[model samples]
Target: MAYFVTPEELVTSNGVDVRELGTGEQWYEAQPD
Candidate 1:
């Protein structure tokens, strides 16, 4: 299944602050096992 993440979440996950980049929805695909 596919997954979705917001720009803020993505940035935060990478150790960056969400406020620095703003927020937006983005789609991602699952990797093959």
Candidate 2:
């Protein structure tokens, strides 16, 4: 079975920054933070 994970859950489980994990995946990266 397949399931989805929320960004918060991902961070809690891996203890990683969402932005760091999404280095090459964040489409909105081009826009200034």
Candidate 3:
């Protein structure tokens, strides 16, 4: 599994702006079991 920090500004998978996260916040994608 891998994770990355979100940029200063980002767009969600659903194409929505997520400005709540702080810079360098860890972001992850959901994985199937």
Candidate 4:
């Protein structure tokens, strides 16, 4: 499966910015902006 953050994780606006976890071999589910 492709890697990505969940829809719930993307909708929040008041939390600390953090890293997206993954290894380099995986494809992304989205363009990651």
Whose TM-score is greatest here? 3
What are the per-residue Cα lDDT tens digits for candidate 4 across 1-33? 223444455322334222344322232334354
- Candidate 2 vs candidate 3, lDDT winner: 3
Off by over 4 Å in 4: 1-3, 11-33
Which 10 successive residues of model 4 have the least lDDT summed? Answer: 16-25
lDDT of each: 0.39, 0.41, 0.44, 0.35
Compare the candidates by lDDT and give the number of the best one.
3
Each prediction's RMSD over C-alphas, in Å, is: 6.5, 9.0, 5.9, 9.4
TM-scores for all candidates: the values are: 0.25, 0.22, 0.31, 0.19
The pairs that clash in candidate 4 are: none
After superposition, which runs of candidate 1 have C-alpha atoms over 4 Å from their true positions? 1-11, 24-33
Candidate 1, residues 1-33, lDDT tens digits: the string is 323345445433345543454432321322232
Model 1: worst 10 consecutive residues (lDDT sum): 24-33
Off by over 4 Å in 3: 1-5, 20-33
Model 3 CA lDDT for position 20: 56
How would the candidate models be sorted by TM-score, starting from the highest? 3, 1, 2, 4
Q: Candidate 4, TM-score vs. the true structure?
A: 0.19
Tens digit of lDDT per residue, candidate 3, span 1-33? 333325654655555454555422333334232
